[model samples]
Target: MLDSETKATETPEDHADELRLWLRLLTCTTLIEGEVRGRLRERFDVTLPRFDLMAQLDKAPDGMTLSDVSKRMMVSNGNVTGLVERLVESGHLDRRTSETDRRVQVIRLTKLGRAEFRRMASEHETWIADLFADLTPKDVRELMRLLAKTKASAQKSAARRRP
Candidate 1:
């Protein structure tokens, strides 16, 4: 049987260790994301993108403009606009033109939206805890530290590539 680090088609002999590590990281992320998506749908009847958008708004109590939400969520404005439209239609979000700029639309969670998000967030925290239950506190801390370094390295590489 192949070990977790080894694939039948690509062994350590055929690929660099770094390539294997990247694949391992991607697989882990995909698996965890799929699980979380299923749980959010089953428990809250909400899609992950919708939940994610709400999460962004939850952080900004005063609310966020569509462009700001798009940037923060790392998505296109069109995607954010669609999410906002659905959320507003469901009465979970309030939309209004900015007082300072009529062309800028800002959105905030309604009372019901905040309340529901809080409830979902509380349970989501527990779900995350359960998902990582196998990792010890020290392991979690070490992974976090290493991932921070990895992020910094990636950002530096990206900066070098950008014009």
Candidate 2:
């Protein structure tokens, strides 16, 4: 039988509320991402990176280039290339050589790919909502505002530290 055990960690009673909020945020992100990835794999046999790339493209008015995808994903060019290649091979995406710039290849979702992405995105939204179902709509709105504020501050701090 598996034992449901947990190790103890030092409590930050000196700053317990802030510590608890940070821990909760971390735990929620991990659990939500885990469940999101699991659903994608189960339903489409797709990895999260590929799904993320497709999702990003879906939001763009124009399709993305290989370099653009890499930059937006904050991943290495090689990594994006590998994932895009796999997606292309699976017939979920189409690659086109740009007429204005032959060197740039634009990647766009095929009709099938668009359909798949839309369906998955719908389900993903549902999953995230369900995960936070216990929270009221007002609570959710407040949480989003707070999280956005936190993210902005963090980014500002990072910018200041750049050498």
Candidate 3:
């Protein structure tokens, strides 16, 4: 059987609405991701994964492990390891051998990392909010509700495919 993407070439007249929704969603995601990535590079000279890891650490005062970052970021364990190593080398974070479990290494943001994360996090929120600033409160609420439902359905589909 052809994959959904391959079958999408049929351009079924009956599926026009779904096609339009997917195209719009794709365009929106690409635009937002590109803009945010450009802003991060221009403002902080930091990669998204490194910034994301720092953001995760910023939320937890006690810090977390490499596996924790991998789970939260939805990245491979090897990718997390490389990113964490680079951050540690840059003086933005540290990984200490766990005392309770000597086999585990816990990662945390340094003072410099926390300060940088605060600045970036503030700007990130402003940028995201600005994207919807033209919408009224009702519009924003409705969009959030619809998007949440769509997101949940997509997640369920992905989960079903996993095993």
Most accurate candidate by TM-score? 1
- Model 2, residue 20: distance off in Å is 4.6
RMSD of each: 7.1, 9.5, 5.5
lDDT of each: 0.93, 0.85, 0.89
Could you give the candidate ranking by TM-score, starting with the highest?
1, 3, 2
In candidate 2, what are the lDDT values of residues 78-143, reduced to their tens digit? 898789888899888888999899999899998888899998889888887788889998998998
lDDT of 3: 0.89
What residue pairs are clashing in model 2? none
User: How far off is residue 34 in model 2, in Å?
Assistant: 0.6
TM-score list, all predictions: 0.87, 0.78, 0.83
Give the least accurate 10-residue stretch of model 3, judged by summed lDDT.
6-15
lDDT by residue for model 3 over 1-163, one digit each (tens)?
7778877886554868888999999999999888888889999888777888898999888999888889999999999889988999999998899999987889999999899899999998898888768999999899899999998998999999995
Q: Please give the distance, in angstroms, between residue 96's alpha carbon in candidate 2 and its true position after superposition.
A: 2.7
**What's the CA RMSD of model 3 in angstroms?**
5.5
> How many residue pairs clash in all the candidates, one count each?
0, 0, 0
Which parts of model 2 are misplaced by more than 4 Å? Answer: 1-20
